[model samples]
Each structure stands twice: as structure tokens, then as C-alpha cells.
Target: MGVKTYDAVIAGGGLIGGAIAWELARAGLRVAIYDRQEPGHEASWASAGIISPAPEHPGMIPLVPLGKASAGLYPRFIAQIEERSGQRTGYRAQGTLQALFAREAREELSTLVALHHGLGLACDPLHVEEAREMEPALSEELQAAALRPNEACVDNRLLTRAVLEAARRSGVEIFAGTGVEAVWQENGRCAGVITSAGKTAAGNTVIAAGCYSAGIGGAGSYAPVRPARGQMLALRSPALQIERVLWSERIYFVPREDGRVAAGATVEYAGFEKKLTPAGILSLLEAAMELAPAARDAEIVETWCGLRPDSPDHLPILGPTDVEGLLMATGHFRSGILLAPVTAQLVREWIVDQRVSLDVERLSPLRFRDAPNPAS
Candidate 1:
């Protein structure tokens, strides 16, 4: 039998890859996704699933526009996927509460509020009592809090599943457990992928392989994505209640629909190794206990880690590459789940219409070509 050809081939099966495949398939193009493990078993499955455009750190503020765009598309995107897959993605728009723990932290609230306000983003400052009243689970030590009503979250694992199912329904052939060993190129363009199962041909090939993207042969030169390890843990707190996502400088807690309070994460420069260290767990538990005293009593349900794909500047390396027919949708860092919908839309527009609606020149894969090596 001759090798099956697809209109587009996706390397990687995480949320980014899966969402892209779903979008392409929905656009009436045959697609194929190659993954070493079952799709979304890595970072997507381990994510706390918080979708806050409000920066977790000062460095992330510049990327808020991208986050906001993606967040806006979530409602319609989730609706479409759920209807097609017959699965609930557990997407919630309840907003997020940024708790101010120290007196000094309270001083920074006005500046943070102003920053968001300057961008015309929705952010409401709350008094300590007001914050406590909104979420009684918060510790009494909280001096102030801010509510970003536009921010939301979802069960990333469930969303990934829905995307995969929707892609299958849209005629995308998903090759789970099939690792793409090399980029099958022809005439100086990306033709397809060579997987363990067999070679699959396509007009366009997408490297959405997350942390492992740089390791793909023939793509290492331009895709300089590296793994930034994040350690996370979940606790089963049936009685401990929190209405929305809660955050402080030290840690953040996300309440699941099923009474599991997901708390994360310790960002480390450790490459690829996803081992849950004792230090990581201790730091998370300490933060959780400090924020909500009742969290100490909550049963420890699971401890795991995820390798977030990070670029040098922490922005995603999206859009087309110098290699013809080769596109990129990786280096999303922690925003993979939050960016899925917009990314899918971006890829669709780029491939079908030959033009991108969103300005992604900053995220172009060629941006890293002149960067100096860290070892030097």
C-alpha cells in the first residue's frame, strides 16, 4: 500500500499541536499528528490550567496582549469543540484573585492596578475584608487583593482530549506513540515527517513538539526551544473551598470542579528531568499553608512535574520559518493551554489564506538566529 498523504503534518501531540491539527482538519484539510506518547500526557496534563493575562511576573506583562486575544476566543472555541467531541472541557470564567500577603505587597497593588488599567484590562482592587468575604478560604493575613475578571481557567487535560477527538472527527489521522525521528524534507522544503511507523507526506509540516522541538533533526538550527521544568502538586480538599483561582507572590491555587485544589509550581532551569524534588514539594506546601491555613490538612493527592518549552526571551516562537513549508507553534512556556485557541486560528489563517491576522513578526522562528550561545 502507498503511504497515506495529508495536507498538513504536525510533529508533537500536546495541546498546541492537537489544537492546530483540529483547526486544520476543521478547515477541510487532511491532517496527521505524530507523538511518542499519547497526546497531552506531558505539560498539558500537568498544567494547573489557570488562564490569567495579568502577569505572574513583570517579564510576562508584555505578552499579555497575546494572552488576552487567546482568552477572548476561549468561549466560542470551547463551545465548538465540546459540541463536536461530546465532552465537557471544564472551562471556567470565574476570574482570578491576586492576594497581597505582606504590607509591602499591598504597596505594589496600586502600581499593578495602574499597569492593567493602562492597558485597558479589567482589574478590580479589593479591600482585605472584601477579599476574605469573596473567598473565605483566604488567610486572614492578606492585606489586599485584586480581581482580574477577564482571566479564566480550564481543565487542560480535558480540553486536550476534546481537541484530539474533534480532530479525529474532522478526519485527522492521529498516530499516537509514533515518534517522528526526522524531518522528511524534499527540494529544500519540509515535505513531511519520518516516523517510527512510516513516512507521512504533507504539503506543510508543523513543529509543535514543545520542549523537545529543538531536538528534531533538520529543525535544530532555527527552533531553539529548551525545557524549563516546573514542579506541581495537587491536593484533595473536598471541604476546603475556593471560588476562583487564588494567587500570591509565592504560589497559586486552582480549585477543580471535583474538589481537587491544584497548587503549583516551582520554576527551575533544570532541563528535561521532571523529577519531583523534596524542595519543590516543601516550597509549594509552605506557600499553600501560608495562603490558606486549611491547606495543610488537605490530603496530598498527586505530585508531578512538566517541562515547559521556553525560548530565550520567554515568548513563543510561532509562525513560519526560513525553511519553506515549515511552520512553528512551540516555545509557549506556561501559556500553551491559554494560547491554544488563538494559535489554532493563527495557523489556520497563515496556511489557508497565506496571511496571518495577528502580527507575529516578534514571534517569528527566525528571531533567534543571531542570538549568542549561553555556554559562551
Candidate 2:
């Protein structure tokens, strides 16, 4: 009506931003999303879309509730996206198996199994022979496998596409290939963003630029996000059918619907570097081959890299900053894809109505204000 200052203007049109825009638009708010490239071309595309619950490491038990909430929202979330995009998100409800090759490794796997079971999440313990029989691709290695039935995966690329399409369907404006060079502030509030195209728009703005958040002119000081490059390879195996996701000591193998098994990923701390290293590729291939000998037989087809935007604390930075009407939703680290639903819901609630149903104070940007690194 009044030129629509936009109930929200979001940066980084990947899974998190697109999801938030879709929810906000559905709730009848004017929203706009700015992206350096088209949505889902970054880490969201490279992501395996694993929806595993936070692994129980004693002190991190609180994450279970948050993860379960997001997972609970998945059924409805997937349905909404499919209905909007007219395409499946590859939402494979098949469970994930954390296979252990030795009794020594079982100690840790057993703890995870106990934790998931104690939390009342569906999971099963399978004998080595049984697991191999279920997926003949699995090596006849020793020990056991813990299957987390409640956790599953989605094709992040399709899910991301669905979110973007849903947002457009709901009237949210999308500016792809229009990079927001900086956040412009007026007085004490968010004015909007200035893009490389020399165009300016004013409204409430959000910083969700993933690893590139640190490069944003005015917002960089508040964004201490560093790029951790994860290199992965895809293998096409017509003779193999890896029905479920498999996890091991070094890496994980996720099978796709198109007769390809996705093997990944090398976690490297190369700053702003997205190049793949020979060592990284070899390591992934070795780990994957050990778990599924069929991987060696499969033709290696694709190799690429994506940066997992990490914070000093490894937790996401959410909530508004000291600047009124300007929000921070970037530092999600490795769990970005898995945590998209909750991030979107929480951020949308914060922008539209000024509060979230959950108390995300611990994850607030203000929590890091006084820390050694304010960007943390």
C-alpha cells in the first residue's frame, strides 16, 4: 500500500532466508529476499540434507528438544513446499544407520543409541550381519549399526527451490544475482540494503549471507562468520542401491534417487577458499570405499565444494542486534540445512510479531556482544 516498506527484507536467499520469506509471506507480510546468486546454489545445494538429531555429547542434550521440534515440523514443511513448487523435495523418510565397524567404536555409537531411545525417538540396533543383508553394499565389517528411524533426509536443492517458489507464490519479492553490497541504516533503525546494481531499497533487513556475511560492508563488524570449505564427490552406481544413509568414523554416504551415492565431506579451515584439495578427495573416497566396497566400483562423476559458514562457538547467531529492525540470522555453521525450519519460524516470528514461541536468548546475537569476539 504505502510502497510496502516490506515487513522484512532478507539477505542470502538459501534455505534459511527463503524458508523465512515463505513463512512471512504466507502470514500476509510483504517480504523481499536479496541474493548474490540464485537461491540454493551455495552450501544448501552441497548439503546432504541430513536431518539427524543433535548427537548426545552430555552437555548438548538441550539440542534434542530444538532438533525434535524442527523434525516435527518437517512433515508439514515438506508438504507445503511440494504443494507450492509442484515437485518433490526428495523427502526420503527412510531412516539413517550409524554403522560401527568395531567393538571399540560401539561404545560411542551405543551411547548415541541409548540417548535417542531415552529421548523416546524411534531407533533400532542392528547386528552386523543384519545390516549388511539389509544393504548388501555395506561391507561385511564387524560390530553393529544403530538406526535412527525418526531422522531422515531431503534433497536440499529441491527443498530450497520449493521454498523460493513458495515465497514468490505468496508475493515475496526475490532479487537474484542482485548482490546486496551493504546494509544502509537511517538514524538508529534499519533503512534497507544497497546492492551492486546501485539500487537501494528501504525496509526491515536481515543478514543471512552465509560465509559472505563477513564481506558485507556495514554488517561485517557484527558478522564474524568464517568460511569452512567442505569438499565432496558424487558416485553413480547403477549396480548398487544404497537405500539408506550411512555414517562412520570419517565420513558419511548418502544415496540419491537418481542412482548416485553422495559421499562427503572434508572439513577444512581454509578461509574464503572453496577449492577442492586432492587429499580431501582421496580421504572421502577411502572412507566411503571402506564402508561400501561397491563405492569403488561406482563411477566417480561429480566433485565440488561449499563453504559451511562457522562461528567461533559453533552455534548459530539469531535475533536482532543493537540496531533496531536489523536482524542477524547467518552463523548457523554445519547445521544450516538441518536447522532451516526452526530458523525460518523463529526469525519470521521475531520480525512479524517481535517474539518467538521459543526463548532463543541463548542463541541471540546480543549473547556475543560482550564476548571476546562480538562477531562470535
Candidate 3:
């Protein structure tokens, strides 16, 4: 029999690839995903699931619009995923509270509120008394706090699995253990992938392999992604009863429905090493207990790490590249969970409609070509 071809073949079966495959398959396109291991077991599973669109730093300003758009799309996205996958994503829309503990916390909070207002973002300064009332587990040292009422969180592990299941139900063929070694290029155009099993031809190809994207032979230039290792631990405290997601200058706590508060994450540039160190866990615990003193009594339930895909400028690399039909949707770094819906929508739009709804020119992979490599 002649080789069977698909409409699209994607590398990396994480949130980005799975979402794109589900979207495309729902649009009636033949799609396949090749992952190095079981889907949704990578960064997607290890994420803290904070879905805030607020720029964490000034450098993240460009991502604000996209992040907000995706955050807005989340309710419907979760509803659809739940309906299709028959599983709840543990989506919590209770918003987030950022507490400050420094001596000059009131001044710092004023500056933070001003920054949010200047950026046209929603941020309401909360009296320390009111903040502590809302979350009684908060430390008595909490000098000030602000509420981002629109920020939300989800159980990313469940969401990833639901998306993967939905993709499977939509008839997207998934090759879990099959790693795509390179993009199959022919006559100056994109084709499909060179997988460990062999060649799989398709009309289009996408590299969404997270930190491992650069390892795929023909993808390094367009997706020069490196791994940023983040170590996280989970604490279960039945008596703590922390409701909203809590954020301090050092660490953040995400409370789940199952009585486990997930605290993370030290951003270390350790180059693909997923090892958890004593210092990393200790720092996380110190920050967690500092933010909520009650956490000191909580039981350490779990500890893990994930490698976020970091680009040269710490911005996501998206959209079409020099190759005709090869597209990129990697380098999301910390925002992969937040940007998955928008990224999938943009990728599907590009492949199926030849254009994206959003002005993603700044996120294009071509922008990297003219820029000096940070490592150099």
C-alpha cells in the first residue's frame, strides 16, 4: 500500500500539541502527534496551573494581550474539555491574592497598584486585615496585599489529560513513545517528520516539543529553546484551609480541592537536569511557610520538577518560520499552561485558514533570525 499521509503531524504531545491536534481534528483534518514519551507527563503535568494574565515583569508586557485573551477563553475551553472528555479539570476561578511581607510592603503595594493601573490591568489593594480575613492562614507578618480578581487556576494535570483524551476521541493518532527526530523537508518546503520509527509524511508540521524542541535536527534555528528547571513541592494541610491562590515575592501557593497546597518553584538554569536538590525544596518550604505560617505544620505530600522552555528573550516563539509549511508553537516558558488555548487556536488558524486572528508578528520565529543569540 502507498504511504498514508496526514494533514498535519506534530512533535511533542504536551498541552500545546495536544490542544492543536484536538482543534484540528475537530475541524476535520487528519492529524497525528509523536511524543518521546507518554503525553501530558512533562511540563504540563508539573505546572502549578496559575492562569494569571498579569505580566509578572515589564519584559512580559508583549505577552499581556495574548495572555488575557487566553485567560478569557478558559471558561468555555474548560467546559468543552470537560464535556468531551467526561472529566473535570479542577478549574478554580477564585482569583489570586498577592501578599507582601517586607517592612516597606505598603509602599511596594502602592507601587504595584500604580503599575497595574498604568497598564490598564485590574488590581485592587486590600487592607492587611481584610486580606488575612479572606485567607486566615496568611502570616501575621503580611504587611499588605492586593487582589487580582480575574486571575484563576486549574488542575493542569487533569486539564492536560482531558485535552489528550479529547484529542484521542477526535481521531488524532498519537504515537506516545515515538520521538520525532527532525522535520522532513523536501524541495525547500515542509513535509512531516522523521520519527524514531521512520518517516511520517504530512501536509504540515509543527514543533511544540517544549525544551526539547531544539534537539530535533531541523528545528534548532527556528526554535532555539533551552530548559529552565523549576522545582516544586506540595503540602497537604487539612486544618490550613487556604482558599485563593497565594503569591509572595519569592513563592506562590495554589490550593487544590483535595486539600493539597502546591508550592513552587525555583527557576534555575540547570540545562535539562530534572534533579531535585535539598536547597531547592528548602527554599520553597521557607517561602511557603513565610507566606502562610500554618504551612509549616503541613505534611510534605509530593515533590517534583519541570523544565520550562525558555527562549533567548524569555518570550514565546510562535507562528510560521522560513520553511513553507513548518510552524512553531514552543518557547512558552512559564506561560505554557496559560497560553495553550490561544496557541492552539493560532496554530489551527494558520494551518486551516492561512491567517491568525491575533497580531502575533512579535511572536514569530523569524524575529529570532536577526537578533543576537543571548548565549553568544
Candidate 4:
């Protein structure tokens, strides 16, 4: 027998790869995903699932457009996934409340409101009473607050599994435990991947292996990605009822439909280590209790850590590379969940139509060619 071939071979089984594979397969292409381990067990499974388009900091401004676009696509995206997989994604559109606790919180909130308005984002400054009315569990120290009504959150663990199932239902073959060691280049063009099991040929190849993308031979230059560890914990409190996702100085709390509140996370540049430290856990607990006093009495349900893919610039490395038939969709860092829908749509457009509706020139993998090797 000869080596198996496909129209597209994605070298990652995480949300990015799975979503892309599903989109391609739905478009009548033979798509396959090779995952080193179980699909969706990494960052996608470990995310808090906040779906806000507002930039967390000024450095993330460039991603706001992409984030907003993805946010807009989420309703249809979730409906399709749920319809195809016969599962619920636990998507919640109750929005988010950002609270300020500093003594000068009112002044700081003014600055925050100005920043959001400058970015053309919807931000409604709220009186502390109004914030408390929305979420009775808010800390008494919350002096100022803002509401981003368009923001949302989802059960990411459920969403990831649902996407994977939807992909399978759409005819995308999944090879769990199949590690792709490198992109196979032939005749100066890309030609699928060389997996640990064997070589697989394909017309086009996409490296979406998250932080491990840099480990794949022949892909380091375009995907100089590294891992950023994030530690998080979950709490259950029958006495505390939060209707919206709550964000404070050092922590954000996401309330699930199952009565679990997810609190996270400390971004540590600890390479590939996924261990949760005592300090990390302690800080998270402190922040969580401070954000919502009732959380102090909540039961600790779970604690976990995940490695987020981080590029040197902390922005996603997307689009085609200089090598023909090769593309990249990794290094999304903290916005992987928020950017998934747009990423899948863009990758599919590039593969099928050879063009994209959105201008992603700055996110191209080739942009790293002139920059210093980040992996070095």
C-alpha cells in the first residue's frame, strides 16, 4: 500500500486544528488531524472561556478587530457545532463586569472608560450600586465598575469536545496519538507531514500545534512559538450567584451553568511546565475571595494548569508562509478561544478560495523572517 493522502493535513488536534479541519471537510475537502495526544486536552480544555473582544491591555489593540469578528461569528458557530454534534456548548451571553477596587478606583475607571471609548468599544460605566444589583456577590470594596454587554463566555471544555465531534461528523479523520514530527517538503513545495507513525502526503499542510509548533522540524522559523503556563482553579458556592463574568485587578471569575465558578489565572513564562504551584493557587484564591467575598466560603472543586502558545510578539502567527502549500495558525497566546471562529474561517478561505475577506497582513508567518529567531 502507498502512503495515505489528503487534501489537507492539520498537525494538531486542538481547537484551532479541529475547527479548521471541520471547516475544510464541510467544504468538501479530505481533511485529517494528527494529534500527539488526546484532542482538546490542552489549552482548549483548560480555558476559562471568556469571550470578550475588549483588549485586556493596550498591546492587544491590533487583535480587537479579529476578536470582535470572531465574537460575532460565535452564535452561528455554536449553533452549527451543537446541531452537528448533538451537544450543548454552554454558551452564555450575560456579558462581563469589570470592577476596580483601588482607593482611586473612580479615577482609574475613568481612564479605563476613556481607553475603551478610544478603541471604539462599548463600555458602560456603572455605579457600584448598579454593579451590585447585577451581581449581588460582588465585593464591598468594589468602588467602580464597567459593563461590556456584548462580551460573553462559554463552557470551553464542552465546546472543544463538541467541535471535535462535529469535525468527525463532517468527515474529518482524526489520528489521536499520531505525532507529526515535521512538515514534508517536496519539489520546493509543502507536502503534508512526517509523523512518528510514518509520512503522510497531502496537497496542503497546516501547522497548528499550539506551543509545540516550533518543535516540528521545517516549521520553527515561521512558528517560533513557546509555552506560557497558566494556573487556574474552580470553586462551587451555593450561596453565591453571579449572573455575569466578573473581572477584578488580578483575577476573573466565570460562573458556569453547573454552579461552578472558574477563577484564574497567572501567566507565567515557565516553558512547557504545566504544574500548578502553591503560590499560584494561593494568589488565585485570595483574588477570587477579594473579588467576591462569598467565594471565601465556596468549596474548591478543581485546580489545573495549561500551556498557552506564545509568539515573541505575543500575537498570533497566522496565514501562509513563504513555502507554497504551507500555512500556520498558532501562537494565539491568551486569545485562542476568543479567536477560534475567525481563525477557522480565515484558514478555510485561504485553503479553498485562495483569499480572505479580512486583512490579516500583519499576522502572516512571513513577518517573522526579518525578525530575530525567537526560538534561538
Candidate 5:
């Protein structure tokens, strides 16, 4: 190949950044990704892999297309990776079954149903008995439920491994433990990024550092990304074979291939602190017990905390910034894993065609007009 300075330098080797780097490499760009730790072991690894755009807020209608488009890309993406890497992403289209436990939760179901339907998605409301019949482990007190048949999920950890493999196979260099110190600028335009390792990564750097995107210099106010801590737990339950992804108000359970049930997530604004708390763990356990009694008998195998990259407007920051060459693809909140596929494509288009096919104006990095771009 030509003297490689890397056609694109991706900050952060998480799902979003890794996928983008892989796609860019496939698009004939010599790409490299940097991460402070192991790729996919953060929020992307600490997720339940529920790809449902089902239970999301009705207010997020504008972004539903983006999510659905991403969801569509996943099947082919996972298929390619699984074939190439011989590692299963555990891609499942079994759908998500969300339950209603209280009157308030029942009321919330209507809004979810409407939103899903509006997106041309298939949603079926089921009576309590029907719901329990579908999942006999459900409590008798369950009020209502809904199923979005097209909703799907994947084993996020496996997906991450596949992405890492695909990227490596595509000749993308991954530098773990290389943190970005700052984005270098000269003449008031875009330049390069300086790594904490004392190395300078230049020529089309994409700041996709998840929650830490704000810490990098020249990230500017463009980084509206915030760190929302989510505590998760996994239980080894050979007794509970959940056929589909199950969800209640505060918790959800996604079954993996190894007879382990992945249940999660308490969203707390705990600031960069990834420590798992007893209170959060207790709350999730109680919720799990309520949702699936079999879970109460299962052994708690693991617990962890992940930082969801959130934004001020509760939407992800996508597309180019005011900086000439620097692009942003962060702040996915709880949906980072689900949105990874599309984010990769969107970012690759920006790097290649200098445009994306999706209507990403709503996720503009410059959305906050008063937000100032920083200097290196």
C-alpha cells in the first residue's frame, strides 16, 4: 500500500468507533482506532443487546427511521462477521416482549404501541393470560403486554469481537491504551489529534470516544455527550430458558447461548464513576425477581457498570462539526449498541462521499448554536 499515515483515525475503539473504522477500511481508507482500554468491554460490552426500538419514547419519533435503518443493517452485518470470524454474534430476531405491571405502566404501553405502529412496525397487544401463556414464568399480577415481532437483539460482546476481527482483517490498526490528549488545530481549521501516548494521529480524525468525548481538547461544545451510568447483572439460570427478550418497566432479561440470563440496567447520572452499587444491584434483582421468578433462584454470576454516552437533548450527536475535517458520532445514550451499524455507515459516508444518505440534520454536532468550538 501507499505510505500509510492512516486515511482516518478513529478515537475510541468501542462499537461505534470500531464499526466505523472497519467500514472505512472496507471503503478503501486506511483506518486506525484508539481506545484507553479493551474494545467493546465498556458500555457496548456491558449491554443486554436488546435491539428493540419498541419501548422507546413516543417523542423520539423523528429518530425512529435512523434506528430502524440501523436495525436493518445488523442482520447482514452480523452474518458477514460470523462467516468471516467464525464467531457468533448470537443475532436473534425473536422480538421483545414488554410487560405492564401497574396501571401507570399500562398507560405507558399505549404510547409505545402507537409509536411502533407509526413507524410501520408490527406490534400486537396481548391480554394478561395470553402474555403469561407466552411466558409462563410471568407473575399473575401482570396487567398487559405487547410484542414487536420485528424487534431483534444480538450478543453485543460477540458482535464487538466480530467487529474487531473484521476491522483487523480489513487491515485497520487498533491501538488499545492510546488515549487522545487533544485535537490539534492550526490556522483556525481542522488538523490532527494528539494521543496520551505522545503520538499524533492526523488526517481525518473522528471523535467517537463515547462518554469521554468531552474530555478531549477541541471537542468543544460540540461534545454535548454526558456519562449516564447503567448498572447491569447476569445470572446463571439453567432453569430459565427465555425464548425472547423480556422487559418490564425498570428491568429486562436477555438470554444468552450459555444458559446465562443477562438482566439489567439502572440509569443513574453517576458521572464517570463505574462502580456497581448494592442499591442498584438490589433494585435490579428485585425487578428481575418480579419479572421472572426463576431468576430469584439463579446464581448471580456477574455485575458491572457501563457509562452510556448521553446528550443534552437525549439524542445522539452525528455528522460533521464546524471544524473542517473532524466528525462526531457519539452520545447514543442507551441505544449505542443498537445504533452502531448505522453510525458506522453514516460516518463512512461522511468520510468518503462527504455526505450520508440519512437525514441526520437533527443529530448535527452544531445543533446547539451557542455552543462554542474549542481550540487545541
Candidate 6:
């Protein structure tokens, strides 16, 4: 018997891949997503779900437009997914606060605020008292803070599940616990993927396997993604009434509507090992306590690690690859949730419509063809 073929076969069933599957399937394409484990249980579940461009580096300026575009589409995008999938994603628009503890950091933040304002992003500098008024749980000794009113967050794990459900509703075939061993090609053009179960053919293939993307056979050195492990913990504090996402230089606090606080995360290049270290938890807990002293008594509910896909330049590797009919949409690092909508929309445009409305040349997989390996 011939192997079953799909219009699109996506490797890696994380948020990016799931979103693409939902979009493509909704557009009447027969799509299938294969993941080695349960979909979205990896980095997507471990994410803090904060959605904003503030935390990105200055070098990621090229991606700002894409991030903004995704942020703009999130409201409608999430609502549609929820309606279609019949699941709530815990979406919140309470905004975010960048807290400054010292005078030096406050001074530095002023420049960042100015830059953001110049770029037309809505970031307002807040007086210490005003900051306290907005988030009464904040430390009283904070020197300064800034508010990004447009920034929002969603429960990424819930969102992932919703996307997967919506994809299924749109007739996308999902294959969990299926690892694609290689990109099966013929006549020098991209074909399909080889999985432990067998070969699955597709007219176009997308490698969205997160940190494990670069290792997929037949991809060669196209995807320069590497594993950057991040550690995070959640605190269940019913009494802590925090309204917005709080950010400091060291840690971030995301207040869930159910009174749980999500605190994270440490960026460590410890390879594929995802052990939860005590130091990682201590540093996060200390920072969380500094932001809200009462949180010290909060019960630590969960601690886990995720391997984020990090490119050398730290921007997402999206759009087409050198191989025809093959695409790449991994290496989103911390901004996976923030960039999912735009990535899906653009990928759909490029694959089904033959062109992307946004100029994503910098994000193309071809950018690192001549660049030296990041490990060196």
C-alpha cells in the first residue's frame, strides 16, 4: 500500500506547529502534525505565557514589526480558537509592569522607555507611588517602573490545547508519540517525512520541532537552532492579589485569574538536560519575594524546565528554506506565544498564496548559510 499523503505535514507539535496546522486546515488543506511526545507538553506548557516585545533584545529590532502584528491579531485569533475548540485559554489583558529596584536601573529604563515611545509603542513611565497604586503588592522601595498597556498574556498550555482542538475540528490529523526520523525527499525536491510508524508524504513540509529542529536528518545545517534550557516554577498564593504581569531584571511574576502566580525563569545553556536545579529555583524565589514580600509564604506548586529553541541571532527562523517545498518555523525562544499568530498567518500566505505580506527576509532560513556555527 502507498503511504498516506497530506497537503502539509508539520514536524513538532508545539504552539507554532499547532497554530500553523489550525490555520492551514481551516483553509481547507489536509494537514497532519507529528510530535515525539504529547503535543504542547514541552516548552509550550512550561512557558509563563507573557506576551510583549519589551523583553526582547535590541538586536531583535527586525522582528518588532512581526511581534507587533502578532500581538494585534491575538484578540481575534484567541477568541476564534476558543469558540472553535470550546476551551478557555486564560487570556488576560491586565497589561505589564517593568519594576526598577535601584536608581541606576531606573535611569537606564528611562532610555528604553524613550526608545519605545519613539517607535510608537505605548509604554508609560510610572512614578514609584503610581506604580504601587497600580500593583499594591509591589515592593515599596522600587525606584521606578514602566507600564505597557497593550501587553497581555495567555495560558500557553491552555492555548496550545485549544489550537490543537481547533486544528482537529478543522480536519487536521494529529499524530502524537510519533517521531519523524528524517525529511524524506525525492529528485532533490522536498517530499515528506519518515517516522517510526512509517513514511508520511506531503506536498510541503515544515520543521517546527523547537530545539530539536536542527538535528532532523536531511535538514543539513539549514536550521541553526540550539537548545537553551529555562527553568520555571509556579506559586499558588490565593491571598496575593496582583492584577498585572510584573517584570524585573531577574524575574517575572504572572498573576493568574485563579490567584496563582507564575514565576520564572533562568536562561541556561545546559544542553538537553532539563533537571530542575535548586539554584534556579532559589534565584527565582528570591526575585519573586523581592517583588512581593508576601509571596515568600506562598506554596510552591510546580517546578519544571523547558528547552527553548535559540538561534545565534536570537530571532525566530521563519519562512522558506533553500529546499523547495520545505519551510522552517522554529527558534522563537521566549517569544513563541507572542509570535505564533503572525508566524502562522505568514506561513500560510507563503505556502498557499505564494507570497508573504510582510518582508521576512531577515527571518529566512537562508540567513545563516554562510554564518559560522554558534557553538564555536
Please tell me which predicted candidate would have the highest lDDT against the true structure: 4
lDDT of 6: 0.88
Give lDDT per model, in order.
0.87, 0.80, 0.91, 0.92, 0.82, 0.88
Q: Give each model a TM-score.
A: 0.97, 0.93, 0.97, 0.98, 0.93, 0.96
How much does each candidate deviate from the true structure in C-alpha RMSD?
1.6, 2.5, 1.5, 1.0, 2.6, 1.6
Over the stretch 1-376, how does candidate 1's per-residue lDDT look in tens digits?
Answer: 7887989999999999999999999889989999988888988888889887766677877778888899999999999999999999888899999998787876789988998898778989998888998899899888889998988889888988988998888888888899888788888888888889888899889999998888887666567888888898888775568889999889999888887888999889887788999999999999999899889789998888999988888888888887788898998998988999999999999899999887778888888877743322
| Residue 179 local lDDT, model 3 | 96
Question: How well does candidate 1 match the true structure in TM-score terms?
Answer: 0.97
Scored against the true structure, residue 150 in model 4 reaches a CA lDDT of: 88
Residues 207-277, candidate 3: write the lDDT tens digits: 99998998997888888889999999999886678888999999999988898999999999988889999
Off by over 4 Å in 2: 1-4, 56-62, 118-121, 370-376
What TM-score quantifies how close candidate 2 is to the native fold?
Answer: 0.93
Better of 2 and 6 by TM-score: 6
Model 6 Cα lDDT, one tens digit per residue, 1-376:
8898999999999999999999999888999999999998888888999989664667877777888889999999999999999999999987899998866977778886988886668888988899999888888778889999999999888999999999989999999999988999889888999998999999999999998888788653667788888898888865567888999878998877678888999999998898989899899989988988878888988888899999988988888887888999998988999999999998899889989999888888888878765433
Of models 2 and 5, which has the larger lDDT? 5
Identify the leading candidate in terms of TM-score. 4
Worst 10 residues of 5 by lDDT: 367-376
Segments of candidate 4 deviating more than 4 angstroms: 370-376
| Error in Å for residue 165 of model 3 | 0.3
Better of 5 and 6 by TM-score: 6
